[model samples]
Target: MRKKRQDFHFTGENNMIRRLVATLREYIPSNRGYPLSVDDGFDETALCARLEERARKGEEASRMVRLREEKRLGELFEPESIVKHNLLKMVCIDEGCMPPYIVQSESMGGNAGTWGSFPCVGANFIYDRMGGKIEHFGNIQYAPRHLINGKFAEGTFKLACKIDFHSIPPSTQYRVVKTPSFTPATDIARQALEETVEQYNKIYGINLLR
Candidate 1:
């Protein structure tokens, strides 16, 4: 006997992912400039040199100023964390997710006001594999830490993810499917998700399978 085919439509969560992906596509080209690598192209010496140059030019010398300056300079050098923070803010506002808050730390002394939280719910690309294992990529809830004033500094809330957005294909679709009960509701939904992933993977010359 032949099997029946299922029709799929984007669930509310999946639709949100789609929007987030779209926003990323629009934002990356102009803002990020290039793909991120293992080191994320971070160069402490170069960053310090640039900061020193700015200081010599009489730019604001506050610790927060320096931090923001580092963030701007690292836009291309350390794109992952910076890009993650940027996308998280945009997605939070667009999806009405929890607003990001600034973290306070006495260790930061007067610069505590510069730290910001990372509080998004899930990965931008999530799915369930066979045998009930859940997999995901491009998390929105990642916080990047830096050494400020010789102190190892971090935000108020910190969440970590293995993969960053720059590592994933630009055309990659975003979802939040999980195992067991949270899997796609219908066969159509499963097929749609699988097909989208496959299509983008082939086009972008990458494999997302595990």
Candidate 2:
């Protein structure tokens, strides 16, 4: 039988250093790779040793290449990036509240709508502000916000959220608060919200209000 070469993996420190340097070079940006900073020679040896140690700890060369590719792709474009103004909510849903009112078209009020079903009908916060502050509160009211069946679908449904205006200590008497206000409606916010809902439906494979 022929003896196999022991030098196949790495026979000495020189081989290890060579492998590390090659791997580092392959990750250089001009090679169409990730933004790995170039070595200025001062910490090269230490960095190579650390990388070799990582490799010994099961981080393979192929995995490093894959990571560099992923980093490059992420830098180029990220999947499912939020467009900021795409979020929609009118009020904050309190965690401890029971049976929070859900907003939907009157057409979806019957037993046919699945949004009222388990998991889908649960409590959710609808913030009026981008950072989720400034919650709107009041009776569940409907405005001619959008249209569905008509030529111009300007129908809207908003839930009236109950909150205490003033609470006196040691008393259960809670004064009724006036409804909170949202900013003047705009086409951009509406469009972003609609698109976000469509995206959510596509991702979860669920049918929200048509």
Candidate 3:
């Protein structure tokens, strides 16, 4: 008798493994570039140097972005760094990328379907600025939100994300207790969006709106 294939559901552990693998893959450069191997008398030192130089150039090129990290992550802009590049591109929301389902925002987030032309929520990246399990982030909420009166709403947005500056080092992930930053979203309509944010946090485990 033929056996049936077992179906697997992606739980937290599976998701973590997927993210860890995805993160490691970034540092693994594509071998298609170098043609010479040991059989061709390749120099290990020269190859390592070439890889480093290529990675540095790639890192520098991506710094065109203007993120809120300007006040914090100035080191990444330096001429030398792999960590900076890693942090910048850590969250992969771009389409057709590896583990493409990992989302950094509502746009990249999974859709529960549409609600009267509005999109509903499905799955999303649960980032713990205290640097927890979630590695995917867009940092889109760092901007301040404006109220109808054109006043900058600070505290409400302050309830948003928690960026653990401490965990962004060579070791450790997130500790749950550390400094947090607020990613406020601007409402062009200039309406009070506190309730909206709260609901979003409660439903999707997002740091915003709560």
Candidate 4:
């Protein structure tokens, strides 16, 4: 029997859009896609209305783009690959708060390995924070080389999993959890990563290892 398709809905007002526009206007040059004039008068109701309208339009446009891309990818990759791509994309969405240089698994050539090999099916943090100071963070994977003390060096952290292609839907065998070492910085990063993963799994009725 063909399963009925379920529509995905946004849970609430996407405040990220508002926060992003505000942040971009501060750093991005006026000539580089942002408007030059800033509205000094703040109107909460009007702003909310405009933001809702923009979100509606943006969602429509995003759906069209996704459909086109999915159709194109369908020709080049297997169904499983497409599912993995979409799953990784959800993992990458910024929810207004995330560490810098964190990237999508697909961007790091995730799911590219051969059968039985561990594919990079998780997100990656490119750098680390030390003593609550981000400026002290380094890219080296070991301590002393990147840090003054003997403690662990903050380096690339991967939160990913291995998939068993033979597993049936809703089965625990589908995902094998691959966890990164725990550190103060990684503890914070893991919270953010898990939030997105949990939200996606709950909305889709899928079992994603947390």
Can you tell me which runs of candidate 4 are displaced by over 4 Å? 1-11, 15-41, 82-210
**Which parts of model 3 have CA positions greater than 4 angstroms off?**
1-39, 67-124, 128-135, 138-210
lDDT by residue for model 2 over 1-210, one digit each (tens)? 433322223325657667666676556555334433433222445666666676565446444544553454345334433322221122112211112224322222233223333122222323333322212222223322321122221212222222234754321111111112324324554444454444423432223222
TM-score of 2: 0.22
Task: Say which prediction, candidate 2 or candidate 4, comes out ahead on lDDT.
Answer: 4
Give the TM-scores of the predictions, in the order they appear: 0.18, 0.22, 0.23, 0.28
Kindly report which residue pairs in candidate 4 clash with one another.
none
Looking at candidate 4, what is the lDDT of residue 100? Answer: 19
RMSD of each: 26.0, 22.5, 19.1, 17.7
lDDT of 3 by residue, 1-210 (tens): 423423333333434434543453444444655343333344344444455555456445444332433323454345333223223333222321112232333341133443332333322222322212122322325331221122322221111222335675321111111112324334321222233233223332333222
- Among the numbered candidates, top lDDT falls to 4
Clashes of each: 0, 14, 6, 0
Clashes in predicted model 1: 0
Question: How does residue 168 of candidate 3 score in lDDT?
Answer: 50
Q: Write the per-residue lDDT of candidate 4 for residues 123-164, one digit (tens) a residue.
A: 333222222222221233422344544343333323333445
Candidate closest to the true structure, highest TM-score = 4
Ranking by TM-score: 4, 3, 2, 1
